[model samples]
Target: MAATKERALEAAVELLGTDGVRALSHARVDERAGLPAGSTSNWFRTRRALLGGIIDWMAEQERADFSPALLERPTPETIIEGLCTVFLLETGPFAARTRARYALFLELAADDELLAPLSRQRREFERWTDRLVTEAGIPDPVPAARTIMALGDGLVLHRLTVDPELDARPVIERAVRALAASVG
Candidate 1:
C-alpha cells in the first residue's frame, strides 16, 4: 500500500507538473511513475482521491522542510527574506523540472474537489507567516504575510500563464525590503 500510494503521488506530481495537468490521466501517470497500471485507483479509489492524497502528503513534506523552527534566526525580516530565498533558489534551473511539476500541482486548485487540500496548504503557510508577523510585533502581520503570499502567488501565476522568462527576484526583493521597513 505504501509503495503503491507513493507511486500514485509521484505520478500525480509528474502529470500535474507537465502539460498543465489538464492531461493528467491514470494511464499516463502509470507510465510516468513507472508503476503498475490501475495502481492509482488501487490506492486512492478515484482521481480526486489520488490528487488529494498527494496534495496532503506534499504539504506534510513541505511543512517538515520549512518548519517554524527553521526561523531560529533573530530578525523576522531576515527570516522572512530567507524563506523567500528558499523559494527563489528552489525554482532555479536545478529545480526547473520540479517547478514544472509544481505548476501541475497548483492546477488542481481549479477543481472544487481538489482545491480543498490546496486551500488548506495555503492557509497553513499563511498562518506561519502570521505567527512571524505577531512575533515581530509588526502591525497587521496577517495581512502583511498575506500580501507577501499574494505576491508570490502572482509571480507563480505570471510564470505559469504569461512569461516563464520573467525574473521574480527583483520584485520579491523589493517586497521583502518594504515589509522589513514596515516591521522595523
Candidate 2:
C-alpha cells in the first residue's frame, strides 16, 4: 500500500493544476485520494509537512527527464525541443494540478512549510539552467534561463488555452534556431 503521505502529496500535486494553492486542504486531499478521513494528518502529522511533500513531488516530476548528456553534447535544437516537451507537460495533462500547487507555493513562499525541499530543488534547477545557458554560450545564464522559461511558458499557455490546435512545432523550431543564432 502506498504510504498515506505519498498518496496525499500525489493528490495535492494533481489538485494544483486547476485549483491553485487555496484549494489544498487535508480534507480535500484525502477526498481526492479516496482515503479514509484523517489519513493525511495521520501520516504527515501537520499541514506543513503535507505542503512540503507537494513541492517535493512537483520538483521531482518536473525534472524527471533531464540528463547530463544534453549538456556534454549541447545542441540548440535539442535544448529547445527538450524544454518545449517539459513546458508542454506543465500546461497539458498535468497542468491543472500544477497550477493549484503553484498557487499554494506562492501563498506560502515565506513559510517554512515548503522551504527545505523546494530549496533543494531550486538549487538543482539553477545548476541545470546554468549548464544549458552556459553551453549556449549566452552572455548571462540567469537572463537566458529567465527569457527561455518565460517564452516557453507563454507559448504553452497559449497553446493550451487560446488555441486548441495551435501548431507550435514550427514555432518552437524557429525560436530555437533564433536562440542558437544569437549564441553564434
lDDT (tens digit, per residue) of candidate 2 on 130-174: 678778665556766666766765777686568866666677677
RMSD to the native, candidate 2?
Answer: 3.1
Worst 10 residues of 1 by lDDT: 92-101
Per-candidate Cα lDDT values, in order, are 0.66, 0.69
Off by over 4 Å in 1: 74-76, 93-113, 159-167
Best by lDDT: 2
How well does model 1 score by local distance difference test? Answer: 0.66
Model 1 quality (TM-score): 0.77
- Per-residue lDDT, model 2, residue 180, is 55
CA shift of 153, model 2, Å? 2.8
Instruction: Give the alpha carbon lDDT tens digit for every residue of 1-184 in model 1.
Output: 7876776676676566556456667777777888888876677777667666767776776676667886654265665566566555445432433454366456654677667776777688888878876676656677778887788767766665678676777787787667767833
